[model samples]
Every structure is written in C-alpha cells, then in structure tokens.
Target chain A: MDVLLVEDDYYLADDTRRVLAAAGANVAGPYARVAESLSRVAQGRVDCGVLDINLGEGPSFIMARALKQRDVPFVFATGYGREVLPDDFNEVELLEKPVDPRLLIDAVARACRKHETSEV
Target chain B: MATLAGAMNGPGADRLSALPWEQTPLGPRAGWPGSLRAAIDLMLGAGAPCALFIGPQLVQMHNLAFDALYRDGSAATRALGRSLKRDDPDSSLAKAAGEVFAGRSILLASQGWTIGASPGTPAFNLSCAPIRDESGQVGAMLVLAFPVTSPARLDAGASISELQHRVRNLLAVVRSLVARSAESSDTVEDLAAHLDGRIAAVARVQGVLLRNPHAGVDLEGMIRDELLTQSADQDRLNLGGPEIVLPPKAADLMTLAIHELATNATKFGALSQASGKLDITWKLDQAGARGQQLELVWMELGVAIASQAPRRQGFGTNLLKRRLPYELSGEADIEFRPGGVVCRIAFPLAPVAAMGSSSVWGVTTTAGDDA
Candidate 1:
C-alpha cells in the first residue's frame, strides 16, 4: 500500500512514518506543509493519505482536497474531534491520537478500500 | 423605579416571594412542581452566582451573585416567565437557556454576565447543567456563573474547543517525546534521565504560562530557571537583554532548546570546568511587517570545540537546526569555534496578549477563579 502522510511536527511525522513502514506499507512524502504535499499529489500515484488537521500555518483541508481530486481516500489523524472539520468533509474517517497502530493501519486499509469500491 | 423598590424589599429569596407567582407560566408558588421548587430553592440559597431556567418557556430566577445582572429591576421583573430568547436572541443567557431546554448541557463564556455592581458588563465563565424532575426528565437547567473576570477569560479567542485542541496536541507531543527520547539514548538509564529532563523542561514552561498568563513568560526568568535547575554557578553566567515575553507558542520549544544548550554547557562547556564562562545575550530588533525579532547569542568560552561537540544527530542538535526554524519560522546557527560553541537564534515575536489576560485596562482578573 502507498500512503501519503502530512504533518508539520517533526517527531510526529517521523514517528508515524516509522509505524507505517514497519507495517510493510510504502509511505510517500510525510510532507510537513500543505504546499509541499500539493506538488507531490500532482506527481500522481497515491493510494491513500493520512493528514493532521491543523498545520503550523492552517488546517490541512487543502491537502485533503488535493487527495480527493485524485479519487484517493484519506483519514484525518488529528488532536481534535469531528467538529473541527468542515461540513464538506463529513465522509472522511477520523482517528484521534495517539491512535493505536493497529487502528491506524485498519483505518488506512478502509480508506484504500473506499477507493477500490468506488471504482465499481 | 417601582421594580427597584420591589427588588429592594429584602434579599433575593424575599424579592422572589414578593413576585405574583400565580400570574406566571410556572403558576402559583404553592402549586409549583417538586423539580421546579427544588431548582428555585437551590438558586435562591446558593452563595455563588446562579440562574435557574424552568420549563420549555424559560422562566427565570437567580441568586445574589447575579444581583448585578438584575440591578435594573424593570428589565428583571418584566423578563420573568418569558423566554430568555424573546428579546436577547444573541445573548449567552438566551443561548444557554435554549440549549438547556433542548437537553444539552454546555459551558459558555458569558460576555454579558455582570460582576458585582460593577459599572460595565464584564465577561463570565458559565456552566449549564440539566436539573431532573421527579419523573427523571430534564425539567430545568441550572446556569452557574463561575467567578472568572473578563481579563482572565482565556476564552476570548481560546474557546473551550481551542483549549481541547491544545491539550490534545500537548498529549501527542508528549507521546512523541517519549519515543524519540528512547531512540537517542544508548542505555535505559540514559533514556529515563533524558526523558525526565525533557519533560521537566516542558513542564517548567507550562507552569509559568499557566500562573501568570496575563504576564507572558519572561525570557530571562525562563533562562535563569533552566540554568538554576541544572545548578549552574550564577556568577560565571551572564544573562542580558530587555524583558521579553515569549509568545506562548514559542515558549515551549524555546525552553527545550535552552534546556539542551544548558545541558551541553553543564557537561562539556562552562559549567563543567573552573576556567569556563558562558555569555547569553539577546537584542530585540524591528523586523518590518513581521513585527519584532528576538536575536539571541549563546557563546561559551574556555571549552575545547572539537572534542566537546555532541553527536550531530542528538535531539538538541536536530531541534536547534531543524525544528526551531520550521516551528517558529525563525533562524538558528550553531558554530563550533575555538573559544566554544556559539549558537545564534532569532525569531519574530507574536503577541501573547491574544492568548488571555485582559490586563490591558490596568485591572487583573477577579480573584474568584471559578473556572
């Protein structure tokens, strides 16, 4: 599985990538900012994405939307609950931290499945 | 005038009894239901600020703490038996009453709650809870005003939701700290000691931030505290610069960075040797549109550079070189010179007053701390 991760915090981004890599998943750019992720999403070939809601600059909805335009599924890895999300993102799955590694892996699988099932 | 005369007849309870309860939607006091009666008793007898909203129509009664809110008795008496939302559609009192009647308990920062007989309406910290009736149904809601002064109202932009986000983010940061600290240490003992020191650094920042939120964290005080914790000799170390209040967001990481520098100095630099000395100086400069910039220089003397240089990948090294610039949108440079390690860090300052502390008007928040 190919998963893109976006988080501004250095330790969190690094730690999350380690967890995903250990689970045998190929992690894409764990980009620290939305602008950094935008170009990567433009490069295509993404299966799913995991996003932190609030970046240093603002919310990561821009990255979330970029992934959506590619028909890619994504989950929000956030400190906040669903209320923090915009109304348009009701369908996105939310896993509050510190998320269980198994839960994160399962959430990623479910998000990836959303991509495959929508194809039919 | 007559309303004031009526309200002044006696205490809050007596004034409440003086009301013609028979004409109200809640009906005569003699025939009032147990739940309504219980809530009324609670509000009347309570020593703290409280308001009771009975039934769906939102009839109201309050305690002495809220006496200022009803000081204008004409509005107070006329508001009885009427939906609080009737006139004040946007008020927190109305919103709390509306939500409570709908069966959801909530906390609201009341911008309208008057403190004492104070001239202006200062903000209040209010909590709304459902009061159950004899039938186990939400019959009334008790709205209690916590004695929070408008100044300490961290809720200005920092609503409860924002606080939750910060608190949760803090937890995540702590979790990541534990994992990363373990990665750096060679022994379990090293991990324990390093992790404890890191957490202590984080806690020291949090403690100052919490106590004097109005007065932003003092940079000199923060530096001194870190060095003091390490038991560094004060006379050899020189701290200079004007009093700078670190923007709350920058305080934590800055504290950690300073902790790292102090630890390094204690182990290999100034604090370690009799001949060593450290000079930490800072200057505040205008950075145009980005506001003020704090330029700090940490220069240690009398220590060998090459042999004392810590591992390049240490947590302190990464934080200073990478995280500081990224998180604070600032600049940092650590150069190993013959004299010692010279580290320069500079960052733009954001205002801390935005976080809380309504002290701009020269008044501290009330002492009640009911929040």
Candidate 2:
C-alpha cells in the first residue's frame, strides 16, 4: 500500500512517514503545504493517505474533498477535535494528535483495507 | 432647593455642600427648586454607587461610592455640580446624558468611559431615567452609574494570559519530546514510534483539559481514553472505578504516565498477545487530612514478560517514577513481573469543591472509540 502523508510540522511528518514505512506501506512525499500535497495526491499512485486538518495557512478540507472526489480513503490526524471538521467529512477517520504510533499505523492500514475491500 | 439645611446629613452630603454650586448655572442651593432638592436628597441617601444629573444644565450630584470613579486628583473635585457639557465633552457619560435630556431614558450596559486624563478606561453600566416634576415635564435626570469592568474583565484577561502561557509550555514540551526521542532511537522508525507516543500522551491530556477547562479531569475517563487509543479490542481491557476528578496538574502528569504504560503493554506487555488481559482499578483513600488520596493500580495479566528489567531507564520509567512524583506530588511503583507489567500510582486528590462546580464530568473518548 502506498500512502501519501500531508503534515505541516516537519518533525511530525518525518515521524509519521517512518511509522508508515515500518508498517510495510510504501510512503510518498511528506509534503509540508496544501499546494504541494495536493499536487502529490493528484500525480502520485496513492492507495490512501494520512492528512492533518490544519496546514498552518488554513484547513485541509479542500484536500479531503479532492481525495473524496477521487474515491480515495484517507484519515485525518489533527490536534483539534472533530468539531472543526466539515459536515461532509464526518464519516472520514480522524486521528487526534499527538497520534499514538500504533493508532497511526493501524489507521493507514485500515484506510488501505477499506479501499481494497471496496474495489473487490 | 430647600435651604441645604437638614439635607446636609446623608452620604456625600459634605462633598455636595463643599462643592462650588453657586458658580454653576443651577446657582446657589438655597434658591434651587423643590424637585432638585428632592433629587439631591435621594442621590445622597443611597449607599450604592449612583449619580444624578439634575435639570437641563445636567449638574452632577453623586453619592460616596460613585466618588471612586473620579479618583484622578482634580477630576473628582472638578466634576462636582458642573454641567456634563462643560466636563469631559467627549465622554460617553456626556453623550448618554444628552440623550436623557431629550426625554429618553437610556440604559447603557458595559459602556466604556474614559474619566479625566487617566489612561485606563473602565466600563460602566448606567441608567439615565428622566425624573418628572409636578407638571408632568422631564425635570431632573436621575443617572445611576455602576462600575462593570474590573472584576469580570480582570478574570477574563488573566485566563487568556494563563492559556497563552500553558500553550507556550506545551510547545516547548513537544520540542523536548522530539529531541529526546531522536537521541534514544537507532532508526527513523524507532524515533517516530517513541516521539509519536509521547506527543499523543500530551495531546490526550490537552484534550481532556480543554473539554472541562474549569473542572479537573475525570480519572476513569482519561485512563480508558489512553487504553482505547492503543487498541480497538475493548473486551481485553477491563476498567472499573468510581468517577474520580483530578486537578489539572495531576491530570496532565497522569495522562503521560498512563500513555507510557499503555504503549509498553501494547508493544511487549499484556496487550501484545491475542489472549492478553488488562485490569485497571482505583479507589479513594479518604482518610487524608486535606482530602482523599487516590490509589490506582494497573495490572496486566495473561502475557509472558521478560525475565529481567531493562539495564537502563527509558522515557516510560522516568515519566512514571520521576516526573509523576516531581510534578503531581505522587508516587508510582512500576515492576516487571514474570507474567506482565504491574504499576501502582497514588496521589492526593484536591478538594472536590475546589476543582470547580461548573465542570461537566462527561466521559469524552477520542474519535477512535467509534471506529
């Protein structure tokens, strides 16, 4: 499974990539901004993704919406609670920060599992 | 006015008499109308802070409590018996007084008023009611001024500053966690696991605190939250305890401690296996002098453990034993048994009433609980 990780914090992003890599998922660019991450999501062969809702500039709801349009499964990793998320993304998996490493790995795996099950 | 003779007996009566009323448009007190005299009497008699701007000239007559509003040297003395138009023309009090003079009774709430040359502009909730004479005309305007800003505003400002300070401290804590985790891990994967676990612990604490900002954190709820984050199988974990509210300081420290324990269990302790079991129980030792002391025990069962403890102390051990003790004034005993890890923590609970009455004690699990 190839996972795209979008997070603004460099340290947290690096850590997340490492966790996913260890969990046997092929990790893509750990993009630091919405524009870069959005382009990566468009260009890369991403199976699923882990997204941070707040990208320092604004929310990543647009990214989530874009992924949803492409029928992609993704999980939100945020410091803020679910109340800040849009109504449309309510069914999307949310992982509150600091995300437990086990939970993070499990969520990305689950996202991939859901995608695979749906495709079959 | 009725010769200012017997009327000079109430509060602020001496100040009222001492003022140069003869120099104002209302002229001497001896020649003032009966309505004006009655208004002055009523203003001085009240204990609460209030002022009366009498007649069309809007002359000022306030009580003793109202005097504090004009404590700036000459401003207090200069304001007495003077026309609102003549004294501080740009003030909200002057503007509100003008509206009252136009036969309108206005109640101004939390209105800012800059008194004299003072830089601090305090808020005042004032009501300007038009006092009618015997002929049914708007005779004297009775102005009631109540200081509204000091207590409430001071509290809000303090809370905001405290929140900012806490956020800065939390950020510093995150920075330290990342740096420390990097030092211990050999590979990037190891570093991510360590750093993410610690950061998640801090975030969990923040979530609990943010939910019930006024009240202390719920002990049972916090423990369950930490455990639920590590695994989806709730059947393996048995958490039983009465509702325990911990002070913010204790809650923050305990969250990290519990996280460390849970992380260790998931990796190598009870939760590492399919048939593994975990039991968390806590009770209050209410015999303490100040308040109840909480004794919590986390016992991991049905899993094989290492024969010996680690050679060196890790973050989990340091947080439970050293950090917990230093920060929350508590003690923790973590032992690696042959079966699984057993940890015991004891801390003095702050008085229930002091923890704040307005706090909602609802159990708020993370988003993963539903998943």
Candidate 3:
C-alpha cells in the first residue's frame, strides 16, 4: 500500500509515518510545503493521503482539490475543529490534531480500502 | 503696554519673562498693540488653561496652566512661538481657532483630545473665541482648555470588547487542554498533575502577553522559562535559538509542548540522572517555497538505559507527536536513540502581523512573508 503524507510539523509527520509503516503501508512524500505536495499528487501513484489543512504557506485545499480530481481518497488530520474546514470538503473525513495513533491508522486503512473498492 | 508689564509682574511673572517671546512672531512686548497687550493681561491672570493665537499666522502665547498639561516638557517648550496651524494641523483647537479667526465664536462643550500613545493619554475639553483689536478686526483667537475627568473611561468600552474576546478564546483553549490532559493520564494523580502543569503553561504565556500586549511573546524566552521551572540545575540543560516572536496561540501551544518535553526528561529521560545532559537548538530555514520555516532539535544525552522506554505511548508522547504538528502546522520526529530521545520539529513562521488579526480558523495560500 502506498500512502501520501503531507504535514509541516516534523514530529507529527514522523509519528504518523511510523504508524503507517507499521501498518504495512509505504508512506510517500510527507511533504512539508503545499507546492511540493501538489507536485507529488501530480505523479498519481499514491493509494491514499493524510493531509494537514494549514501548511504554514497556506491551506492545503489546492492539494485536496487535485486529489479529488484524480479520485484519490484522503483525510484531513488537523488540530482545527471541523467548522474551520471548507464547505466544499464537507464529505471528506477529518481527524482532529493530537490524533490517537489507532485512529490515524484506521483513517489511512479506510482511505486505502475505499480507494481499492472504487478502482475495482 | 505698562498694564501688560504689570500683569507679567504678577504671579508666574518671572517664568513668563524668562520665555524668549521677543524673538516670536509677536516680537518684543514694547511694540505690541494696546488691544493685544490687554488680552495678554487677561489671559495671564486667568486660573485656567488659556492661550492667545495672535495675528493671521496664529502664533501661540499660552499661560502656565497650559504647559503643565504636557507630559513632555520639551514638547511644551518646543511649541512656544510656533503657529498653532503648524503645531497641530488637524486638532480641534486648530479648527476652532480657524473659525474664531473668521469672526465666529465656537464653544466646544466636551471635545476630546489625546496627548500621545502612552498607556494613559490625557483627554481635554476646549473652547475658543475671537479676540478683536480696538478697531474691531479679529487680532487673535482666545482659547481655553480643561482636562476631562476620568478620561480612561472614555476608551474603556473598546478595551472591554477586546478583553472579552481574548478571555473567551483563552477559556476555549483551557477546556481543550483539560480534555486532552485527561485522555492521556493513567491514574487520577497523573491526570491532576498533568492538568496542573498544562494550565500553568497557559498561564505563563498569558503573563508574557499581558506584559507586552502589542508585541507577541518571545519563543526562546518562553522555552527557557518552561525549562527552568522543571530543572533545578540549569547547567545540565543547554538552549540556543534566535529571537522569534510567536503569536499568542502559537506561544501557548509551544509552551505546553516544551513543558511536556522537559517533564519527560525529568521523569524518565536524560534529566532523570545527575550526569544526564540535554541540548535544544533551533534555526530558521529560509529556502522554503512558502515562507521561512523554524527547525528545532531536542537531543537528550547520557540517560540511563532504564529511562529509555518509560511508557512508550503517553500524553507527553502524543502531544509531541500529534498535537504540535496538528496545531502549529509543523512536523515532528521523535526517535528513541541508544543514548536517549531525539526530537526534531519544523514549522512555518507566519509573519507577526498575520498572527493576531488573520482568522486562526481561516485557511489561505498567500506566500508573502511580510515580517
């Protein structure tokens, strides 16, 4: 399983990477900036992605839009409440920050599983 | 002119004579018109803040009461002989003086005027009338000013509004802290201790913010304050970082995260032993596409093997690993090295101006680092 990770916080990204790796998913590009993450999304090889909404440069909505266009499944892992999420992304899954490791693993697994079902 | 000399010889006579009014637009008093001299006598003898703006230039001649109103003596002295038009272009006094010069008497009941940007700006009420010569032409503008009682209350409503907003946000943060702290604790004692520490961290940030309400809290200073509270001997800890001002929310979150790290080091990490050492260093990474990013590293050295794996997944671990990244839009890498724990964190440093006004909830993609 190939999972895309986009988070600017080094510690949280590494922690999420460890959890995903342990779940047997190959984490790709925990890209810290929006531009780099968008470039990785353009490659189209990611099975799933976990994104932080605010990337310091700005929000990751552009990257989310690109993923949505490609039919790739992703979840928002952020500290902000759901009210802060864009109205357009109302259907997407959101895991608030200080995420439980188990919850993160389930979100990624579910995203990857959903992607597989949609492709099949 | 003799009567004008008599007025000057009265109370505050020496101080009035000491002023170099001879070089002013009015010139020597001996050459003054009779109408102007009589007006000066009336103004000098009055027990109120009064001033005479003479001629079309509106050259200023004020009484001692007016000088005491100025907090800065140099500012008061600097105003002497200068035209009111040049001294305060947009002030009510200037505007009223203009109207009085045009032969219209204006009585302002309670117009407000702030002296400066100092914490407490003194406010005043002013009134003015045109002083005419014996020939009936308006020769000068006579102005009277009185200090407003309880001027602080004049601006209290606005301050109270902002204060209410801040207090609400702080309460929300505290609620979140309490909930999160409870989730990671194993026992009641653990929860109590953890909640106390987290609340203290929030309070510390609040203290710094209150001291300098306009400027944000300093990053290095916050970390040092948190670390010092945990460790008795400062020699065991080494901290190095450039000065960075964090927005209120960022400062609060960072203080909690630092507190967590220091607590871990004290209980089951490097600081658990006397020989243990801790080094924390940070630097700005400016080559990012969006804006400057801050990369901070925390490395613990000389920890006993027993302290390496103390509860693998706890509140401290979750906070460092998840909360920081989610809240700050930063990255974190926590590794249990052979010697001790090594945590590296990276987050974008939003320009200071954007931190307070910009909706912490609003997401935008603007790339300019205006700081």
Quick one: best DockQ, which candidate?
1
Candidate 1: stretches off by over 4 Å: A22-29, A34-46, A56-71, B1-163, B212-216, B285-292, B304-307, B350-371
| Model 1 CAPRI quality | incorrect
**How well does chain A score by TM in each candidate?**
0.93, 0.91, 0.89
**Per-residue lDDT of model 3, residues B79-145, tens digit only:** 6668777667787667777789889988765435543323233455667889999899999998887
Q: lDDT for model 2, on a 0 to 1 scale? A: 0.71
Candidate lDDT scores, in order, read 0.75, 0.71, 0.72
Question: Would you list the clashing residue pairs of candidate 1?
Answer: none
Per-residue CA lDDT of candidate 1, range B1-371, in tens?
53433232224776677778677677766666666766777777777778787777667778766654554656555555565545555666666676776678898865545322233333567899989888888888898876566444523333454556667777888998998788788999989989999999998998887776546578999999999999999888988999887856678888999999898888778788777789999999999987778999998988755445666578888887777776666888998777688999998775433333334324332221112
TM-score of chain A of 2: 0.91
Order of candidate numbers by lDDT, starting with the best: 1, 3, 2
Which stretches of candidate 2 lie above 4 Å from their native place?
A1-120, B1-10, B31-48, B67-78, B98-113, B116-152, B155-164, B207-213, B287-290, B306-311, B350-371
Q: Which residue pairs collide, candidate 2? A: A98-B200, B1-B32
Tell me, by lDDT, which candidate is best. Answer: 1
Candidate 1's TM-score reads 0.63
- Looking at candidate 2 chain B, the ten consecutive residues that score lowest on lDDT are B362-371
Per-residue error (Å), model 2, residue B219: 2.6
Q: RMSD of each candidate?
A: 12.1, 17.9, 15.2
